[model samples]
Target: MLEQEKPLRLAAFDMDGTLLMPDHRLGEKTLSSLRQLAERRVTLVFATGRHYLEMKQILANIDIPGYLITGNGTRVHDLNGTLLHASNLPEESFKTLITHKWPTAASFHVFRDDGWVTNQDMPELLHAHQFSGFRYQLSELENISASGNSKVCFCAAHDELLALLPVLQTCFGDRLDFCFSAYDCLDVMPVGSNKGSALALLTDRLAISLSECMAFGDAMNDREMLESVGRGLVMGNALPQLKQQVAHLEVIGHCKDQAVSHFLQHWLNSPTLTYSPEY
Candidate 1:
């Protein structure tokens, strides 16, 4: 139980594994709870590793309005699709990424302002299309430039990705930041760009302090966001690496079980919810 001396004015959520269910739709129970929280004048912001267009598609049916931190925090946008802040990997970093000869089974993706590009036709690409609601154009690596690119991603089997991690880190460790948005997916963004920096930018723009925010996430990419917020709650399904490191983080029910909804419902209904965090 974390103490809340100041009222929680903002609730930031990571999309894929935090707010959305496995099928990518918000359960009625969770949807209702979020709506109610918004109705109470509490701000809701999505701090996710998803692309802007993908985030829009996922929230298409729901009318909940909030800020968006997409592309692993390389881009930040307001509800009306206005770009608040955006960052891109330098040409050198992009060159290094493109130069690498990834395994044939691995799919490389580059996100552009309007859409995304990929090099292979694999099941992972199809999964990306189904999940993101954005069709990608197939382009050769040599033709792909770093201009206007937000983030670069590599998708492979979970175990294969784990094996590839060390190589990637060694090659681009100083130039890029890496985070596992999912077990099978690794996102590489510009250094100093992540959910925490994005959230700080959003809060500064809105005149809110970190102490007045509550964040929820379930991946390694979400570590900074969870740690930066006044109250960071990890979904029961969070990565072992994140859970073990963020010792103060409180565990909630799994995302599939609507843990966020339950927790917010309790916070909205209880005025005396208080406990000091380990950090």
Candidate 2:
């Protein structure tokens, strides 16, 4: 059987760029498709750089038991919000992230188990978190300890973040994973914590093989999970770097057009619909 013909037991999704509209709205068509998949006994996993609480609110439209791989996989929760696995960056990392001389445009945030705390609110971010009504607590970075936190984030202009990337890698690349969660946001999680590793743990516990799973994503953070699954589909709106990074993965329709919803519909009704050939 062609790889895509394999029995699909799980469908993993990355929010923001891959599963959500540019405005961060979850399309009705997408929710309906996920609900149908749940009814079919297919496991649904929403994995992203988002916090669990935020994801919970965003996914309120779907009433079913599913998994949440939040904080880019620093935290994983099961059916009833029971945490399956969690890894936290040490306090030192948080201090360094806070103290580092980031670009003047950078707005920093620390994500802990309780909630997020930011140095200041960047109004531009409102559009992305508005749908979930998730807001951060404003606090000085010095007071925010990284302990119990999944990741530290910095938001700025796209170019500024790109410039900061190599500097971060040079400082802590071996101890942590740095990736762009969005054009303006960079997330730094503990080295071993990521969507791909988290998915493997969840699937192993559920007795599902990697070959039975498919994933969708559109950013550098999604790279590991995309490559780990048997079938990885990259969104047409995926970051250009991501497309070049995972050239072997199939390219699919745009997220703004509800491409994931369309793909799920075809997977259920017509498995032979050809996806964009791998670039």
Candidate 3:
């Protein structure tokens, strides 16, 4: 007798450029498809670099499922708002980042579930605030230093952010983790904390093997989770650098076209559909 294949037990998605459309809205078709997957008992998880509170508000209209691996995996919580796992960058590290005289023009923010704290006021920071829909407090880092924040972020011009990476890596690479959460934003978290680590811990608890899971993503921060899963599907709109960085990743439809939903529908309903790793 042939052995039964391990069923696809979980579907993980990165929000911004993987699941949500360019407008940052969940398309109705995608929502319906997600509901169908939920009904079939396929656990759906959203892993993002978003703050828990901001993600909560953004997903308020939809019944997004399973667990949220937020803050680039510094925090994880269940649908019921139960904290499953959490790791925060040390306060000293946060201070070190905030206090260091950045060689380039950059805006920084420290994030918690309730709100974010920032010491600088810049157009880029304001743009990020609008893009993320998270409120910020204009105060010294010391004022909010006591809060056990999940992460620290730096927003700068594209070129400036790229140039600042080497400096940051040389200075804080040993103590802190850095990920380009967006093209112009860098997120700093604790060492050994990332979306992939979060998924591994959650999967272990769920009694599912990594080979039984699939993940979708579109950015550098999503690399860990996307690469760790048995099947990693990136959006057509994913950054070119991200595409080149990971091996055996397949490019699916664009998020603007609701590729995730279409992919899920086809994946769940069609048995003959197969993934070709030769991208």
> Best lDDT goes to which candidate?
2
Query: Can you write out model 2's per-residue Cα lDDT over 35-72, one digit (the tens) per residue?
Result: 89998888999999989998877666456567999999
Worst 10 residues of 2 by lDDT: 270-279
> How far is 260's C-alpha from truth in model 2 (Å)?
0.5
- The CA lDDT of each predicted structure is 0.82, 0.85, 0.80
Cα displacement (Å) at residue 246, model 1: 0.9
- The C-alpha local distance difference test score for the whole of candidate 2 amounts to 0.85
Clashes of each: 2, 0, 0
What's each prediction's TM-score?
Answer: 0.92, 0.94, 0.90
Candidate 2 lDDT score at position 269: 88
Better of 2 and 3 by lDDT: 2
Off by over 4 Å in 2: 1-6, 276-279
Candidate 1 deviant stretches above 4 angstroms: 1-5, 123-132, 271-279
- Candidate 2: clashing pairs of residues: none
